[model samples]
Target: MEVLRIILTQSSANYKKEETILNKMTYPLPPFSTVIGAIHGACGYKEYHKMDISIQGKYDAMHKEPYRDYCFLNSIGEGDRGTLVKLNNKNFLSTGFDKVAEAKKQQGSSFREGTTIQVMNQELLTEYRELKDLLDRIKDFEENRVDKVLKLIKKRKKDLADKKKKVKENKEALNVVLIREKQIKELEKNINDRIKAYKVNEYEIPYSNFAILTTSLKYYEVLNNIELIIHIKSDKETLMDIKDNIYNLKSIGRSEDFVDIKDASIVEVVDTIDGPITSEYSAYIDYNLIKNECVFLKLGDKITANGTKYYINKDYVIEDNKRIFNKKKVVYTSEYVAEEGSENLHFDISSEKSYIVNFN
Candidate 1:
């Protein structure tokens, strides 16, 4: 048996676990579909191409940081918003202040008379957008309100020209600004404290503010110069195609996250002294997994990044467009003897469904 092995390195990367919002997460290693997609992207195949592959990698270290981004989906440009309003005008209800005008004309002589009238109402319309977008707009409004209050406070503080004379005049505005500032500051400080706590405890932090958080954002965990190795086993033709394009692979996760491919080549396998069956070979066990050979983990059907399994199989199923584990099989790498222990698995064994595998 001949297998293609590829080694890749990435400085910083995010394999986002899309199921979580308000906070983002990453997988320990690229899943099967992500790997398949990267290969297809490099090979110029627009659709899924059947292949067999296994991935395992080690990162020097990783840390999470809050990232701000003004994403288009969450925001609207002025012109774009206006155009959308005009295009979707009919959906909104009429405001009470609309102006109504009526005109009537009467014509015709002795024998018969005809009367015609027309009524027109001019209205002000507001379009409906996503609830999130509406909240963003409200957030923007509050931010502006706070900014104005802050500026007023600054002006009042410097209104010391007449001392006693200006004191009473600026008193109300100064009081309003000071009160708002205190409220906003208190909220912001508490949020910051929560962020600090998350860092210390390793919990998911949140993004919210009394002031409009103008910046678009995401949460990311970074991996520094990590080594990623993948094992591929397929027919002669499929293997050849993978070999041709695997070298061209530039990324394994998001487009911006790139891979530094150090090696992409096929290796010859040596057989056992007793037989020609080969010392090592890839075997896939899926839907037909023995009753006690496999275990599936679900958080009451709620999907998450950690413990989400990825495996290799002949058929495929995609979950949330990112999870591509299709009843795939698990392989034993350490001893291959498959006794009762001392084997390395692509997935961290979570339960004792397979006694040969260990769990954390």
Candidate 2:
């Protein structure tokens, strides 16, 4: 004969209430077979009350031993309002209801019999929380670091601009000095020519004995002194070689001057060549990948591809299986590839995913 058991755990307040509702003073430790019969009777009563089924076939099936094991009573809730129901075994097919009920009954008396040990340490939880807080602070610090770097870059740019302005002013002042020196040299030549012409007129004085020549004639003094006494001035100046020397010093400084700047066209050409070119302007190009071969193009160069020489412009198109190069578009299919022995240039080609080629 089959049996159904409803084992109620004492841990639940519902068990006490169900005992009260059933008019059972205590939880009687009934046999599994007896519980099974009670469950079937309860199901029959429920079905009859609902008018869904008559009691005629209910008890008829109840006598069948094979169907008895299929019945179950699931008690849920607490107090006197706890539930009692008779369910078909088909509803609990996958649930292993018979085995569950047997296990529940076996565990019923021993539910609270085991010793309890403290497994969760408060100190460990506190340490974990501290670690999490530290990580959060680290993330915030990194975000602040980015702002600091940006501010530093802005300050650096301002400083560079000021330095550049100073350098330009210095250069202009030096150029003015050079122009004054050039005029002085021309005036000195004119004065020497006038002295020679007067000497040829045959005065008893050798040109060298003339007081103007006897004194180490300072060019500036010759003009100013002569003008003060005779109101006649030689249009002459001095310090031409000294001014040239100063200009040379300034040129040396210019060579040493370094400034950071950007030029789009040069950058584009550098990118196109996949390396740095020796142009009038200084620039840097970086590549992410290595490549075996690259095609060099100049302005208006016709590239023969697919049996046609394609006349390429500033916005020409070049395509390989890995990359598509359009005027303003650069798409890398893999790491930047540079030809062997071309270590001066590197390409950026870190993306492994495929990309589509299109340009506006």
Candidate 3:
């Protein structure tokens, strides 16, 4: 089979695990999607394309390094509960109609997560009209949705009564009055928020206590001076396109980890490669596997993206609008056998299991 061999070298890189949240970790080999994403990045394609990809790489644990993680919490009405944290700065959240355009222009321009909270605050104010409108809405709800406010007001009154009971009868009334005032203010604010929500909720309440962006010291196991070999199995036209602009392809793993592309040539797949585990290959979407506890390797998986590690679980079909790739097979080893097979092959190695796939 004719194939386009693309050689890429990276000095330092980390393929983040899919489940990583807090601490960033690194995978030895790039995932199937990551490779395609990088290629698509260079090609500047709008949508995903269908193409067979073969990836094999050798990397060593260079060292553990720290990186800043950015997360975002969506506004109210979108959902309830915990905020959504983005491991990487995909885009900066901005406020105001003017800043919305500015934000779009600056999207992907910087890897850093900017002042999202500030932007959101600006958005909520909306020329201060929203605040006035919300106040008016709260009053309207008091007359309309009287039941909703009654329960809330009654709760506040009950709490106040309890507080008064706790205080000595002879104590100064000023403190009690101050407490009452504070409670009333809080009650009104809550009512305002609840009523505004009824009228098509707008901005998410960015309470400093609930919404938070924390920075902590974390480390990622960086793969230093690694080389990856990607075989592009596509038609002559696609091959020519890649050959022409292969150099334009950027880093495969992390953006900072630049890939040194070399040896772009047409080649043929040889026989089945039988070898011991010298290095690990990425588990792409294909190579089907059944749902069960399958012991593949002694080591766990690395996801430096959010600094987390998790083993593969369940079987899923890898497909988008443009492509339907392989159905991954379960394996007993950490590495995948990257060889051309006439038919899908599976075998057992003593107590271990392996799956080899062939793509025509």
In TM-score terms, candidate 3 sits at: 0.49
User: lDDT per residue, candidate 3, 218-272, as tens digits?
Assistant: 7787888887766777778777777888888878767888988867877655444
TM-score of 1: 0.43
lDDT of 2 by residue, 1-360 (tens): 011111121111100112232122211111112222232343332321111000000000111011111222232211211111212243343333111111122222211121121213344324333443554554575467644654655565566555555666688765655555555556555655654454344321221111100011111100000000000011112122212222222100012221121110100101233342211111111111111223222224422111111111112224565433222112211121222223233221113311111111
Go through the candidates in order and give each one's C-alpha lDDT. 0.47, 0.23, 0.52
Q: Candidate 3: global Cα-lDDT?
A: 0.52
Lowest summed lDDT across 10 adjacent residues in model 1 is found at 204-213
Off by over 4 Å in 3: 70-212, 271-327, 330-341, 344-360
lDDT of 1 by residue, 1-360 (tens): 566667678987877654657666776666566777788778887666667665656666788877875321233222221111111122222221221222232221110111132223222111122333445654575477645665655565545333435454678865665666566566656655764564434311111100111235666776666676676666777778888887678877678788888877776432222311111221221222222433222234422212223343334677788746564544322212221221222221113211111111
User: Which rank order by lDDT, best down to worst?
Assistant: 3, 1, 2
Candidate 1, residue 80: the lDDT equals 25
CA RMSD, predictions in order: 23.5, 53.3, 15.6
Specify the poorest-scoring 10-residue window by lDDT in model 2. 223-232
